[model samples]
Target: MKQAATASLLAFTAGFVDTAGFIALFGLFTAHVTGNFVLIGASLADFHPGILGKLLALPVFILAVAFARIYVLGREKRGHDGAGGLLVAELVFLSAFLAAGVAAAPFTDADAPLTILTGQLAVVAMAVQNAASRTVFAKLSPTTVMTGNVTQIVIDAVDLLGGASAGAEIKARLKKMAPPVVTFALGAMAGALGYVALGFWCIAAPITSVVLIFFLRRGAASA
Candidate 1:
């Protein structure tokens, strides 16, 4: 139950941040960084002012992932749950993203320096999440990206319907995979709506969710 709750919360955060950034930062994908590659290519054929931010997201994500891994590894070596510390790190970056975004709001130019900085801050926060998902939270279903989760869910459903797998096993898989996917979708919608209503202040929702996760999973030692 704890694992499911945490996974759902993280997925919600990822979806919320990704959508809000996309709407506000001119198609910038803060969580699904690879999606920016498509935007970058499109921008080349057509002209988009935010192309620079898209171009920079991949490298920034890479660096943040490396940092997250190292930080988690160091904590594991000391016999601590690295995820707690990483959660704090993510919260700090998210807070920074919110502050930068609010200050940089009314983004008239996507190529402007502040716009790029704000987008990168979001990228870093999601990168930390991506890395932590692979490290400390590896036991949890992925929270940021839903492609693989949805694929697996479909496969499992088909197998269950065909009786190709044991009923209990298929049900178990569905239970594990469904919540995050659903929550992610809901979060994406909420994010788009929140951005439309509150602009960058919408980020406060995800920040609060992260705080809840941190407390909910406190001292679990394993996720």
Candidate 2:
């Protein structure tokens, strides 16, 4: 149950940041790097002016993930929970992203230096999250990307629905996969709406969620 709650919260945060970034930055995805790649290609082909941010996002994300791996490895060497450290790093980046974004508000130019920096920070924050999910939270279901989750959910549903003899394993898998997907959708909606209503300050939603998770993890560890 704890794992599920953490995963769902992280999924919600990813969806929230991704949607908020997308709407605020003229369709740049903060959490979904693959989407940014497609956008980069499209921008290149069409000579789009906003391509710089998308292009920079990829490398910045890679750098963030690499940094996270190094940080985790270092922490592990010292006999510590690397995941917790990674979460802290993510929070720092996210806070920076939020600050930069708010400071650069009324973004009319996507290629502007401040706009690109804000987008890059957001990408880095999500990249840290992606790295942590793969390394620190490897035991849990992925919370950021939904492609594999959706595929598994569909397969599990088919097995359960096709036969009354379907075992508890199928049900367990569904239970594990369903919440993140649902919560991600909800977060996306909330992010879009929040961005429309509150501009860059909408990031406070995810920041608060992460802070909560950090404290929850700390409490769990201490207990």
Candidate 3:
């Protein structure tokens, strides 16, 4: 239950920061890889290289996942510490990036170095969020984006309640149907509220996530 709560809060934080990036700079959503992939393609053709943004995003996100996987594997071999805390670290860095951006100036300014640096920070944070979401928690809400999760949830509900299958199949369908429905909604609601009310301090989302990480880490240490 506690882990679920942690994942939910982190997911919400990811979305909140990503949306802020959307509002502040390009409407490009850093967490939504599917959309970002398309954007990358469009960018190739259009003048929106957004190249630096994508550059920061793609590789760092991959590395975050790799690092988390390695950490989680070590914890697993040692027989303690679930895979969650590594992700929490990722989220903390993500929040730091977003907060830094909040402290930065408008994009219209020609200060290329600071702009690129902070801009990279923002997208890379989201990239880490994406990697954590999709890679770390298969059943959990991966934040950043929801097209795939939303589609699968609808498919499960309709296929199950639609009565195409029976008994075990129905149970299995519903079982699969469960997590994303709740978590995604939770992420959306929290993300909306945080970004709306807090502006840049919307970082409170991951701050809450860090608290969860602390508890999870304590559990590992005790074990």
How many clashing residue pairs appear in each of the predictions shown?
A: 0, 0, 0
Candidate topping lDDT: 1
Better of 1 and 2 by lDDT: 1
Give per-residue CA lDDT, model 1, range 1-223, as digits (tens). 8889999999999999999999999999999999999988887799877989999999999999998988888888888878888899999999999999898789999999999999999999999999989998899999999999999999999988898748898898899989999999999999999999999999999999899897787645454
Clash count for candidate 3 is 0
Report the Cα lDDT for residue 180, model 1: 98
Backbone clashes in candidate 2 total 0
Over the stretch 132-179, how does candidate 2's per-residue lDDT look in tens digits? Answer: 999999978898898999999988888888984766988988898899
Tens-place lDDT digits, model 3, residues 34-141: 456776677767756355565555665667557666766777788865445655566556666666667774556422556556555665556555555555555554
**Candidate 2: misplaced stretches above 4 Å?**
44-47, 164-166
* 97 Cα displacement, candidate 3 (Å): 1.3
Positional deviation of residue 187's Cα in model 1 after best superposition, in angstroms: 0.6
Q: After superposing candidate 3, which stretches have Cα over 4 Å from the reference?
A: 1-4, 44-46, 82-84, 109-111, 122-144, 164-198, 209-223
Best by TM-score: 1
